[model samples]
Target: MRSRYTAYVLGLEDYLLQTWHPDFRPVSLDLAENEQIKWLGLRVNQTALTSENTASVDFIARYKIRGKAERMHELSQFELIENHWYYLTGEMK
Candidate 1:
């Protein structure tokens, strides 16, 4: 979860895509268009293993865009496949 946050902070769209599950991965995030967004920080509230290969992370990411502050609170889901973890989906909180 932290790594993914860093990816967004750095505008590493390719890296983000690479870590996302193929079934859930979008074709593009268009991070370049969000250049004006300034990522402030990420706070991981909790994490839980739902199953042997599935887990969820509850986090909040703070940022600013056009001098306006905002935050995203999400319960992110992940799946472990072939010893690697991939982001599956997320639900806004």
Candidate 2:
């Protein structure tokens, strides 16, 4: 999660795409010319075991970009694939 966050801050779009789940991957990303997103911090609210191979991580990612403040609070789903956690999707909170 943190690595992906840094990828966004550093304008590493390819890294972000690589980490995303296959089904949820975006076809393109218009990265900002100037890296303006100020990463405040991440607050991991909770984790729930949905099944033996699934889990949900609730978190708040705060930042400021393009002279505006934004916070993405999401309940993100993760699946254990090939002994690694793969991000699937999320419900915005």
Candidate 3:
């Protein structure tokens, strides 16, 4: 999860897509389109095991765009496949 946040901060779209579950991944993503956004930090609020190979993480991320600060709070779901974690989906708060 933290690595995914770091990928966003660095605008690493390829890494982001690679880590996402194929079923949930979009056909394409362009991080450069949001270049105006300056990521500040990410705070993991909580994590819970939902199933043997599934988990949920609640997090808050801060960013600024044109000097306007904003926060994104989300509950994300992930699945463990072949000893690797893959992002499924997220619900924004």
Candidate 4:
């Protein structure tokens, strides 16, 4: 989760895509379109292992866009496949 947050902060779209589960990955995030966005920080509220190969992370990310401060709170799900973890999906909170 922290790595993904750093990916967004660095606008590393390719890296983000690589870590996302294919079933839920988008064709493009268009990070360049949001170049004005300034990421403040990330706070991981909690994490839990739902199963042997599945887990969830709840976090809050603070940022600024168009000079307006904002935050995103999400409960992100992940799956372990072939010894690698992939982001599966997330729910806005």
Give the alpha carbon lDDT tens digit for every residue of 1-93 in model 2. Answer: 677767877889998787777888898677775366787778888999899998999999988887788899999998787887778898997
Alpha-carbon local distance difference test for all models: 0.95, 0.83, 0.95, 0.94
Give the top-scoring candidate (TM-score).
3
What TM-score would you give candidate 3 relative to the actual structure? 0.97
lDDT of 3 at 77: 99
The TM-score of candidate 2 is: 0.81
Which scores better on lDDT, 1 or 2?
Answer: 1
Model 4, C-alpha of 45: deviation from truth (Å): 0.1
lDDT of 1 by residue, 1-93 (tens): 899899998989999999999999999899887799999999999999999999999999999999999999999999999998999999999
Candidate 4's displacement at residue 34, Å, is: 2.2
C-alpha RMSD of candidate 2: 2.0
Preferred candidate (TM-score higher): 1 or 2? 1
Scored against the true structure, residue 89 in model 1 reaches a CA lDDT of 94
lDDT of 3 by residue, 1-93 (tens): 999999999888999999999999998798877799999999999999999999999999999999999999999999999998999999999
In model 3, the clashing pairs are none
Judged by whole-model lDDT over C-alpha atoms, candidate 3 comes out at: 0.95
What's the residue-level lDDT of 82 in candidate 2?
82
Determine which window of 10 residues in candidate 3 has minimal summed lDDT.
Answer: 25-34
Off by over 4 Å in 3: none
What lDDT tens digits, residue by residue, belong to model 4 across residues 33-72? 7689999999999999999999999999999999899999
lDDT, candidate 3, at 27: 86
